[model samples]
Structures are given as structure tokens and as C-alpha cells.
Target: MGIFPGFGGWINQNIQQPLKTSKRSKNGKSSSVSEEDRYIQGPWYWDPDISPKEKAESMEIDHVKSMPLSATDPRYYDLDELVRQNRLWNSEKKHPWNGAPAKVKVKTKKGLCHLNIDFTLGSPPQSVSEMFTNPRNLMYFHSMGKYKYNWRTRLDTRATKVLKKDGPRQITEVEKVLRWKILGYNGTIPIHLIIDENHQKVTATYKKVKVKHMKVFEGSWKIQPLYVDQERLCKSRSRISEEQYKKCSGGKGRIGSKVTMEHIFEPSSLLNVPPVSWFIRGIAVKVTKALLQDLREYVITYNKTETVDPLVYAKIKESIQKEKETELKELED
Candidate 1:
């Protein structure tokens, strides 16, 4: 029933006002997540037939704006096409993936922009995946707005839910209720996404669930080994231990993952109009890049800070408690 560390911050950071930050435990340790993980809600609430109108009402949104683009517009990209030649961040010259001022990037395109945020970590792809792929990590890993007139432009996300179909046609679905505010103007966008996780490709593709509007929001996450040759060389040394790889190889080297989260965002007709359209689009792009910058900080502090992945350590304790309960039951029987 009580709030845990950092969870409320992620939920309220994007809103017009921020919530009171949650406090840590007595020893400054984070407690396990309670069941009310609205951002990571499970399939029990899934309904493939729920109309978008009904969904809007649930969020207390009175209006759903009209679409400005056609169904065939290139801006409304397919999930697999989330990464395209249009990606600005792919260029190592102009908007390099690995760069400083995380919120910075190359020029964005009209109506949409594909953001590729690439970074390396101290751990391998599997550890990075464990930190990211789990919904529980959403609470622990985020960078909130620092100042009042924060230079960072971004969408405020309220809650996220994982949806699925009951039948064979069901694929993983992710729904996010995001708040958009630019230059004192604001609106809400409810996005339903279809998630495609390809293990072999080491990528997760997300596209709009059922594209009703011309507005588009789709993206892909690519996580793969960064310094393979360095990793191989690290293992070649018998004396060098697993923990030593983070510091020993060239000082900045660790056989970590190169994570690329590419997103394509285009707003609806309500905000896509002339006067403020350009400004809003630019804000969206910057906000996304800012989010990537936040992720950089989030990942770096994962295991080393007060905020750690709840699902990982919490699961172990849960399993042990279950085993103890089973033992008590057997003895009583």
C-alpha cells in the first residue's frame, strides 16, 4: 500500500506537477515492488476489442483529436520500418549515437523523427537486457526534469500497461498514456503498441497497435555486444577475473552492450498545424533524446546505487519464502 523508492517519480515526473519523492528504507535500501505496477500492468486487463474511445474515457480524457494524415503516409511508419534511412542519429558525423549532452542530436524531419540513442555499459547484453526488458525497472531507472524551465523538451508519460490477446493471434501489446506539452501548449496521446522481440536479432520492435490516426509513434531497441574483441582478450587472461574486465581493458573498456533505442514520433492534427507544429515536433525529438540521456544515467547507476532492479533480487527472495512455506505445509500435513 505504501510507495517505494523512485516509483512515484517516474509516474509523476512527466505530469504538469511532480509528486513527492518516495523515501528509502531504514538502511536506505529499496523495498520490493508492490502489485500496483500501473506502468507495467500485466495481461489480466487485456481486451483486444476495447475501442479506443473506451480507453480514452478510462484515462479521464474528454477529447480525442482528429487525424491530419492519411493512412498511407510515410510518417505513419510500420513497426519493422521504425528504423529507416531517415534516422538522423545513425550518422556518426552529424548526430552520432555516442555523444555528449545526451539531449543533443542532428536536425529532425517534419512530422516525424527517428532517434537512435546508442551507449555502452559495464555489463554484457544479457545483464543489460535484464535491466531493461523487465517492466519493474521502469520505476528505478529514469531521469526527471532538473529545473523549472528545463531546456529538455519531452512528453510526460503517466502510466504504461502491457496488453495481450486471449487467442492465438495475440502478440505482446504495450499501451502508454503520454502527456505532450510544448511552449505552454499541451495534450494527451494514448498509444497502443505491438511489441516484437526477436532474440536472434537481439532487437525489440514496437509499432502502433491499430493506427486510427495519422499521428505515429513507433520505435525499436537494439542491444548487442559492443567490444567483442576486447571481451575475447579479457577472457584470454586467466588471472583476470569477471569483475576486473570493467576496469582493466583500456580503463574505459568493459565487454558491455551497445544499446540503440530508435523512436519515430509524429503528433496528431491538433498539434501538427502550422504555427506551433514545427516547435512541437522539435520539442518531441529533444524530449526523446533527453529520455535517452536519462537512460544513460539510469543504466550507469543500476546496481551501484540505492535504486536496483526489483524484479531480479526480489524474485529470489520470493522463491525462498515460497520454499519455506512449502516446507512448513509438509511438516504440518
Candidate 2:
């Protein structure tokens, strides 16, 4: 719906997919972001380190951080547990209008706040993962709800910087500007994140860039295919086959995505007092929930709509074709 002019053309061009550079002309410019580089890295378990490194094939790494999609990597948050609680929460059959259909909770852990969110979407995990990470969809993404818990109603978000590293696995260093209001006071937050996009496993692993305002931030998003046809849980979710996915889709041609996001973070402020810290943590929880809500609503609302712009469709098609070409190249190698 061209509701927003040119889909917010005012958005910085860095947020769009960067131009591909061949081996001969690589990393020429845009190498160092002097503006954002000074912020530093946080003390999170999965901090984003863009330093040069040895290839995974030549290294004996034990952590997923070393080799994402590694079988030995810590699963971090448990999807099975979250999905169980989500079912229980929804089965109660009593919820407020804005009460998200997911199990969301936040608690103070050590000196930081830990938040875990779990929910299921109607689309397949691949589709959901692709839509959320694709830059083409970000401008069109927006939340919808009239409930009091809707904080995004007073939020303005834009991608300020994005560096897309395209390869067998896409790595992106991005920073976003979030302007929000609370208690009639306006505030702006800079969220710098390193996104490890693994479409093969349907996961986006993100770690925070330790900016001056951010003290701690690390997280991972895992989307698992649910066997919607049967009432029981899926026995295997990793790289599921097309036939099995179809059989488990409940005949609607629409699969389910068991989505979970886990993050721990703290602000770089001195509000360490009892109630002040609690209040700050509360704000963090609200912001996390609001962001997740926006994504869910965008996926559900737009996936079925026919108003998707032809240009956006073309971009997605091009992306998929390029990805397939890359996959074939790796296979041949």
C-alpha cells in the first residue's frame, strides 16, 4: 500500500543490500566506519568480532561462534521448553487483546537482564527467517495494534548503518536508530548489531556492538519447523525435507515456525540503584517485546497480502537466485 512515500526513501542507503565487489576490488572503501568503530565491543558471550580469522575447515573450534551451524555449538535457549510453555499459555484461553500469543519473560541475571521470547508463526521457518533478515522488507515492516501495551505506536525506527558481507553465509554489521517515548519523555537509542544469517539452519545469531550507550547485549534467533499436522512435537527440525514439511503442514500449504529469541543486555548507565535499575530493565523488556511484536505482525499481515510491490518481489527473487548459485558453487568446490 504506498502509504509511506517511496517506502521511506529517506532511509539511508547503507541499509539496502550493498553492491557486490569482486576479488580484485574488494574492501576498497567503507572498510572502517570511524564513526561507529569507536563504540567498542561489549562483554557478551557472542560479541561480534569482525577480525580476520582462519577458515573453519582448518580450525578445531568447539564453539558455534567459531563455526556457526556447528553441531557442537551450544543451543543456548531451549526451543522445546519454550514451545511447551507457549502452548500452555495459549491453551488457558484467557488473554488480553494485546497479550501476545507467545511466552515472554524477562529477569535480572547477575548485572544484566535476560529476556527469552517464544512464539509460533503460521508460515514456514525459512519464509519467516528470510522475511525478517532481508533488507528489502525492513522499510515496509511496521506493527499494528491498538492495545495499551503497544509501545511501537510511539516509536520511530531506521537503519543508520549496514555492512552486508555476502558469501556462503551472509554476515551483516548493522546499526539502527530507535526513537521512542515513555512517560512523555522522548529518547533515542542506537542499536548496533552483528547479524550472522544462516538460512540453512534458519537462525540469525546477533551480538551487540558495545557502543557507549550499550553495556551488554548478545542474542540468537532460532526458528524451527513444527509438525503442525500432528498434535505432537516434531521429532527432527534441522534441515527438514520438503516432503516431510508438506506432510506436516496440516494441509493448508502453510507451515509453522517455532521462533525463539534470547538476549541478555544492560545499559551503560549508572542507574544501578534498586528501583531505578528495575525500571530500566522494565523498559528493556518492553522494547524487546515491541520489536518482536512488530516482526510477527509484519510477517502475518504482509505474507498473505497481494499488495506487495513488484520491485520488492523482484529483489527477493534475485536474492534467492543468487543464493542458489552460491550454494551450487560450494557444492562443486
The candidate that achieves the highest lDDT relative to the unseen native structure: 2
Model 1 spans > 4 angstroms off? 1-110, 130-133, 147-170, 179-188, 210-214, 228-254, 314-333
lDDT of each: 0.43, 0.48
Residue 206 displacement in candidate 2 (angstroms) = 1.6
Q: Write the per-residue lDDT of candidate 2 for residues 1-333, one digit (tens) a residue.
A: 001123123223434544222211243333333332221221011101112342323124432222311111113332223223233323322321122466788777667888888987755554456445533223323546432454343233233233442322446665555644456665767666787866457687888874435578788889886644333334444656646654564332334678888888876667755677776677777766766676667555554454333322323444567789999999999
**Clash list (residue pairs), candidate 1:** 153-287
The candidate that wins on TM-score is 2
Clashing pairs in 2: none
RMSD to the hidden true structure, all candidates? 16.0, 14.6
